[model samples]
Target: MKKIVTLLCLGILLVNCSNNDDEMDIENSTEIVVDETQEMGTDMYVGNFVSLAHPTSGVVSVSDDMSRLDFKNFKTDNGPKLLVYLTTDTDATEYVNLGDLKGIEGDYNYTIPDGTDIGKYKLVNIWCVDFSVSFGYAELKK
Candidate 1:
Protein backbone atom coordinates (compact mmCIF):
# COMPACT_ATOMS: atom_id res chain seq x y z
CA MET A 1 0.00 0.00 0.00
CA LYS A 2 2.82 2.43 0.82
CA LYS A 3 4.58 1.72 -2.47
CA ILE A 4 1.37 2.11 -4.39
CA VAL A 5 0.69 5.48 -2.78
CA THR A 6 4.21 6.65 -3.50
CA LEU A 7 3.87 5.73 -7.17
CA LEU A 8 0.57 7.53 -7.42
CA CYS A 9 2.05 10.65 -5.88
CA LEU A 10 4.96 10.58 -8.31
CA GLY A 11 2.59 10.20 -11.22
CA ILE A 12 0.55 13.15 -10.09
CA LEU A 13 3.65 15.27 -9.70
CA LEU A 14 4.79 14.53 -13.23
CA VAL A 15 1.41 15.38 -14.70
CA ASN A 16 1.23 18.60 -12.76
CA CYS A 17 4.72 19.58 -13.80
CA SER A 18 3.97 19.11 -17.48
CA ASN A 19 0.88 21.29 -17.32
CA ASN A 20 2.74 24.00 -15.43
CA ASP A 21 5.20 24.58 -18.25
CA ASP A 22 2.43 25.44 -20.70
CA GLU A 23 0.69 27.65 -18.21
CA MET A 24 3.94 29.35 -17.34
CA ASP A 25 4.63 30.08 -20.97
CA ILE A 26 1.24 31.70 -21.25
CA GLU A 27 1.72 33.64 -18.05
CA ASN A 28 5.09 34.93 -19.05
CA SER A 29 4.01 35.90 -22.52
CA THR A 30 0.92 37.70 -21.30
CA GLU A 31 2.86 40.07 -19.08
CA ILE A 32 2.60 43.40 -20.86
CA VAL A 33 5.50 45.80 -21.00
CA VAL A 34 3.70 48.90 -19.81
CA ASP A 35 4.71 52.50 -20.41
CA GLU A 36 2.41 53.95 -17.73
CA THR A 37 2.74 57.50 -18.98
CA GLN A 38 -0.71 58.82 -19.66
CA GLU A 39 -3.88 60.09 -18.03
CA MET A 40 -7.34 58.73 -18.93
CA GLY A 41 -10.65 60.56 -18.82
CA THR A 42 -14.36 59.64 -18.53
CA ASP A 43 -16.47 57.38 -20.71
CA MET A 44 -17.59 58.45 -24.14
CA TYR A 45 -18.66 55.22 -25.90
CA VAL A 46 -19.07 51.90 -24.17
CA GLY A 47 -20.00 48.24 -24.47
CA ASN A 48 -19.57 44.82 -22.88
CA PHE A 49 -17.13 42.05 -23.71
CA VAL A 50 -18.94 38.91 -24.81
CA SER A 51 -16.93 35.74 -24.21
CA LEU A 52 -15.19 33.66 -26.84
CA ALA A 53 -13.37 30.93 -24.88
CA HIS A 54 -14.45 31.84 -21.39
CA PRO A 55 -17.19 33.97 -19.89
CA THR A 56 -16.26 37.65 -19.97
CA SER A 57 -18.52 40.42 -18.76
CA GLY A 58 -17.71 44.06 -18.13
CA VAL A 59 -18.09 47.64 -19.20
CA VAL A 60 -15.64 48.73 -21.89
CA SER A 61 -15.61 52.48 -22.12
CA VAL A 62 -13.98 54.82 -24.59
CA SER A 63 -13.56 58.26 -23.07
CA ASP A 64 -16.27 60.84 -23.74
CA ASP A 65 -13.77 63.11 -25.42
CA MET A 66 -11.98 60.17 -27.09
CA SER A 67 -8.92 60.55 -24.90
CA ARG A 68 -8.82 57.06 -23.48
CA LEU A 69 -10.53 53.67 -23.26
CA ASP A 70 -11.13 51.68 -20.14
CA PHE A 71 -12.22 48.22 -19.08
CA LYS A 72 -14.25 48.27 -15.93
CA ASN A 73 -15.29 45.22 -13.89
CA PHE A 74 -13.64 43.20 -16.60
CA LYS A 75 -12.92 39.50 -16.41
CA THR A 76 -11.52 36.99 -18.91
CA ASP A 77 -8.99 34.21 -19.40
CA ASN A 78 -5.37 35.15 -18.71
CA GLY A 79 -4.21 34.39 -22.18
CA PRO A 80 -0.65 34.88 -23.48
CA LYS A 81 0.17 38.44 -24.48
CA LEU A 82 -3.33 39.86 -24.53
CA LEU A 83 -3.62 43.13 -26.44
CA VAL A 84 -6.15 45.90 -27.00
CA TYR A 85 -7.21 46.88 -30.48
CA LEU A 86 -9.66 49.15 -32.25
CA THR A 87 -10.91 47.50 -35.39
CA THR A 88 -13.92 47.01 -37.60
CA ASP A 89 -13.60 43.23 -37.16
CA THR A 90 -11.32 40.70 -35.45
CA ASP A 91 -9.37 40.09 -38.62
CA ALA A 92 -9.28 43.52 -40.17
CA THR A 93 -6.04 44.76 -41.69
CA GLU A 94 -6.88 48.32 -40.92
CA TYR A 95 -6.81 48.59 -37.15
CA VAL A 96 -5.49 50.66 -34.30
CA ASN A 97 -3.40 48.65 -31.86
CA LEU A 98 -4.37 50.13 -28.57
CA GLY A 99 -1.56 48.45 -26.65
CA ASP A 100 -0.73 45.38 -24.66
CA LEU A 101 -3.61 44.77 -22.27
CA LYS A 102 -3.17 46.08 -18.73
CA GLY A 103 -4.56 42.81 -17.48
CA ILE A 104 -7.03 40.04 -18.23
CA GLU A 105 -9.29 40.55 -15.24
CA GLY A 106 -10.10 43.83 -13.54
CA ASP A 107 -10.51 47.53 -14.16
CA TYR A 108 -7.83 49.11 -16.37
CA ASN A 109 -7.22 52.15 -18.55
CA TYR A 110 -5.68 52.60 -21.99
CA THR A 111 -4.82 55.99 -23.36
CA ILE A 112 -6.00 56.52 -26.91
CA PRO A 113 -3.41 58.19 -29.08
CA ASP A 114 -4.27 61.49 -30.62
CA GLY A 115 -5.40 61.62 -34.26
CA THR A 116 -6.82 58.09 -34.22
CA ASP A 117 -9.71 58.20 -36.67
CA ILE A 118 -12.74 56.88 -34.79
CA GLY A 119 -14.89 56.90 -37.90
CA LYS A 120 -14.14 53.31 -39.00
CA TYR A 121 -13.26 51.30 -35.93
CA LYS A 122 -16.29 50.26 -33.93
CA LEU A 123 -15.00 47.27 -31.98
CA VAL A 124 -12.65 46.92 -29.02
CA ASN A 125 -10.87 43.59 -29.26
CA ILE A 126 -9.03 41.70 -26.55
CA TRP A 127 -6.59 39.61 -28.51
CA CYS A 128 -3.82 37.19 -27.62
CA VAL A 129 -0.82 38.39 -29.55
CA ASP A 130 1.21 35.23 -28.91
CA PHE A 131 -1.54 32.86 -30.04
CA SER A 132 -3.35 35.00 -32.59
CA VAL A 133 -6.61 34.44 -30.74
CA SER A 134 -9.33 36.84 -29.66
CA PHE A 135 -10.10 36.37 -26.00
CA GLY A 136 -13.16 38.65 -26.25
CA TYR A 137 -14.47 41.94 -27.63
CA ALA A 138 -16.69 44.96 -27.04
CA GLU A 139 -18.78 46.57 -29.75
CA LEU A 140 -19.22 50.32 -29.55
CA LYS A 141 -22.54 51.96 -30.43
CA LYS A 142 -23.98 55.43 -30.86
Candidate 2:
Protein backbone atom coordinates (compact mmCIF):
# COMPACT_ATOMS: atom_id res chain seq x y z
CA MET A 1 0.00 0.00 0.00
CA LYS A 2 2.81 2.51 0.89
CA LYS A 3 4.59 1.86 -2.40
CA ILE A 4 1.35 2.43 -4.37
CA VAL A 5 0.59 5.75 -2.55
CA THR A 6 4.19 7.09 -3.17
CA LEU A 7 3.96 6.26 -6.90
CA LEU A 8 0.56 8.02 -7.19
CA CYS A 9 1.94 11.23 -5.56
CA LEU A 10 4.94 11.35 -7.91
CA GLY A 11 2.68 10.81 -10.95
CA ILE A 12 0.37 13.67 -9.89
CA LEU A 13 3.35 16.04 -9.42
CA LEU A 14 4.76 15.17 -12.82
CA VAL A 15 1.39 15.77 -14.54
CA ASN A 16 1.01 19.19 -12.92
CA CYS A 17 4.56 20.21 -13.98
CA SER A 18 3.90 19.05 -17.57
CA ASN A 19 0.75 21.17 -17.82
CA ASN A 20 2.72 24.24 -16.61
CA ASP A 21 5.26 23.71 -19.36
CA ASP A 22 2.50 23.55 -21.98
CA GLU A 23 1.03 26.81 -20.73
CA MET A 24 4.47 28.50 -20.90
CA ASP A 25 4.97 27.25 -24.47
CA ILE A 26 1.63 28.66 -25.55
CA GLU A 27 2.47 32.05 -24.00
CA ASN A 28 5.85 32.21 -25.74
CA SER A 29 4.42 31.21 -29.15
CA THR A 30 1.73 33.96 -29.07
CA GLU A 31 2.25 36.66 -31.75
CA ILE A 32 1.59 40.41 -31.71
CA VAL A 33 1.23 42.77 -34.69
CA VAL A 34 0.96 46.56 -35.14
CA ASP A 35 -0.45 48.50 -38.12
CA GLU A 36 0.85 52.00 -39.05
CA THR A 37 -0.78 52.68 -42.41
CA GLN A 38 -3.15 55.54 -41.46
CA GLU A 39 -1.93 59.15 -41.24
CA MET A 40 -3.36 62.44 -39.85
CA GLY A 41 -4.56 65.26 -42.07
CA THR A 42 -2.15 68.09 -42.92
CA ASP A 43 -2.96 71.80 -42.64
CA MET A 44 -4.37 73.22 -45.89
CA TYR A 45 -4.37 76.86 -44.77
CA VAL A 46 -2.57 78.71 -41.95
CA GLY A 47 -2.55 82.26 -40.61
CA ASN A 48 -1.48 84.35 -37.62
CA PHE A 49 -4.13 86.31 -35.73
CA VAL A 50 -3.64 90.08 -35.53
CA SER A 51 -5.08 92.19 -32.69
CA LEU A 52 -7.67 94.73 -33.71
CA ALA A 53 -9.91 96.17 -30.96
CA HIS A 54 -8.28 94.04 -28.26
CA PRO A 55 -4.97 92.19 -27.72
CA THR A 56 -4.97 88.79 -29.46
CA SER A 57 -2.23 86.54 -30.81
CA GLY A 58 -2.27 82.99 -32.11
CA VAL A 59 -1.94 80.66 -35.08
CA VAL A 60 -5.06 79.38 -36.87
CA SER A 61 -5.09 76.54 -39.36
CA VAL A 62 -7.62 74.70 -41.50
CA SER A 63 -7.35 71.00 -42.21
CA ASP A 64 -6.84 69.71 -45.76
CA ASP A 65 -10.52 68.84 -46.18
CA MET A 66 -11.63 72.26 -44.90
CA SER A 67 -13.81 70.56 -42.32
CA ARG A 68 -12.18 71.93 -39.16
CA LEU A 69 -10.31 74.93 -37.76
CA ASP A 70 -7.50 74.72 -35.19
CA PHE A 71 -6.14 77.46 -32.97
CA LYS A 72 -2.69 77.06 -31.41
CA ASN A 73 -1.00 79.11 -28.68
CA PHE A 74 -4.06 81.39 -28.69
CA LYS A 75 -4.25 84.41 -26.38
CA THR A 76 -6.80 87.21 -26.14
CA ASP A 77 -8.38 89.69 -23.76
CA ASN A 78 -11.60 88.55 -22.05
CA GLY A 79 -14.85 90.16 -23.15
CA PRO A 80 -18.55 90.07 -22.23
CA LYS A 81 -19.77 88.24 -25.36
CA LEU A 82 -17.18 87.19 -27.90
CA LEU A 83 -17.87 85.15 -31.07
CA VAL A 84 -15.84 83.52 -33.84
CA TYR A 85 -16.58 83.93 -37.52
CA LEU A 86 -15.31 83.10 -41.02
CA THR A 87 -15.64 86.11 -43.30
CA THR A 88 -14.71 87.47 -46.72
CA ASP A 89 -13.07 90.52 -45.16
CA THR A 90 -11.71 91.84 -41.84
CA ASP A 91 -14.85 93.91 -41.22
CA ALA A 92 -16.97 90.80 -40.50
CA THR A 93 -19.73 92.24 -42.73
CA GLU A 94 -20.40 89.05 -44.71
CA TYR A 95 -19.61 86.02 -42.47
CA VAL A 96 -20.63 82.65 -41.08
CA ASN A 97 -20.61 82.36 -37.31
CA LEU A 98 -18.52 79.42 -36.15
CA GLY A 99 -19.45 79.74 -32.47
CA ASP A 100 -18.70 81.70 -29.33
CA LEU A 101 -15.01 82.13 -28.56
CA LYS A 102 -13.94 79.18 -26.37
CA GLY A 103 -11.52 81.10 -24.20
CA ILE A 104 -9.36 84.17 -23.87
CA GLU A 105 -6.23 81.93 -23.96
CA GLY A 106 -5.01 78.51 -25.07
CA ASP A 107 -5.84 76.21 -27.99
CA TYR A 108 -9.31 75.73 -29.54
CA ASN A 109 -11.07 73.93 -32.41
CA TYR A 110 -14.13 75.01 -34.40
CA THR A 111 -15.93 72.93 -37.02
CA ILE A 112 -16.57 74.50 -40.43
CA PRO A 113 -20.09 73.96 -41.75
CA ASP A 114 -20.24 71.40 -44.56
CA GLY A 115 -20.66 72.75 -48.15
CA THR A 116 -19.46 76.21 -47.06
CA ASP A 117 -17.04 77.85 -49.51
CA ILE A 118 -13.71 78.17 -47.73
CA GLY A 119 -11.91 79.78 -50.68
CA LYS A 120 -14.41 82.65 -50.76
CA TYR A 121 -14.30 83.26 -47.02
CA LYS A 122 -10.63 83.50 -46.09
CA LEU A 123 -10.65 85.48 -42.84
CA VAL A 124 -11.16 84.17 -39.31
CA ASN A 125 -12.58 86.90 -37.12
CA ILE A 126 -12.98 87.10 -33.33
CA TRP A 127 -15.82 89.49 -32.82
CA CYS A 128 -17.64 90.80 -29.73
CA VAL A 129 -21.40 90.57 -30.24
CA ASP A 130 -22.34 92.64 -27.20
CA PHE A 131 -20.30 95.68 -28.33
CA SER A 132 -20.26 94.77 -32.07
CA VAL A 133 -16.45 95.05 -32.42
CA SER A 134 -13.71 92.87 -33.92
CA PHE A 135 -11.16 91.73 -31.36
CA GLY A 136 -8.81 90.10 -33.87
CA TYR A 137 -8.55 88.59 -37.35
CA ALA A 138 -6.45 86.04 -39.26
CA GLU A 139 -6.25 85.78 -43.06
CA LEU A 140 -6.08 82.12 -44.09
CA LYS A 141 -3.55 81.33 -46.84
CA LYS A 142 -2.45 78.20 -48.65
Top-TM-score structure, candidate number: 2
Checking candidate 1 for backbone clashes, the offending pairs are 30-81, 43-64, 44-63, 44-64
Given candidate 2, what's the lDDT at residue 109?
A: 93
Error of 2 at 94 (Å): 0.5
- Scanning candidate 2 in windows of ten residues, the lowest lDDT window is 31-40
On residues 28-65, what C-alpha lDDT tens digit does candidate 2 reach at each position?
A: 44232323222224688889999999999998989888
C-alpha lDDT of all candidate models, in order: 0.74, 0.85
Measured against the true structure, the TM-scores of the candidates, in listed sequence, are: 0.65, 0.70
Badly placed stretches (over 4 Å) of model 1 are: 1-42
RMSD vs true structure, all candidates: 16.4, 16.1
**lDDT accuracy of residue 115 in candidate 2:** 86
lDDT, residue 8, model 1: 73
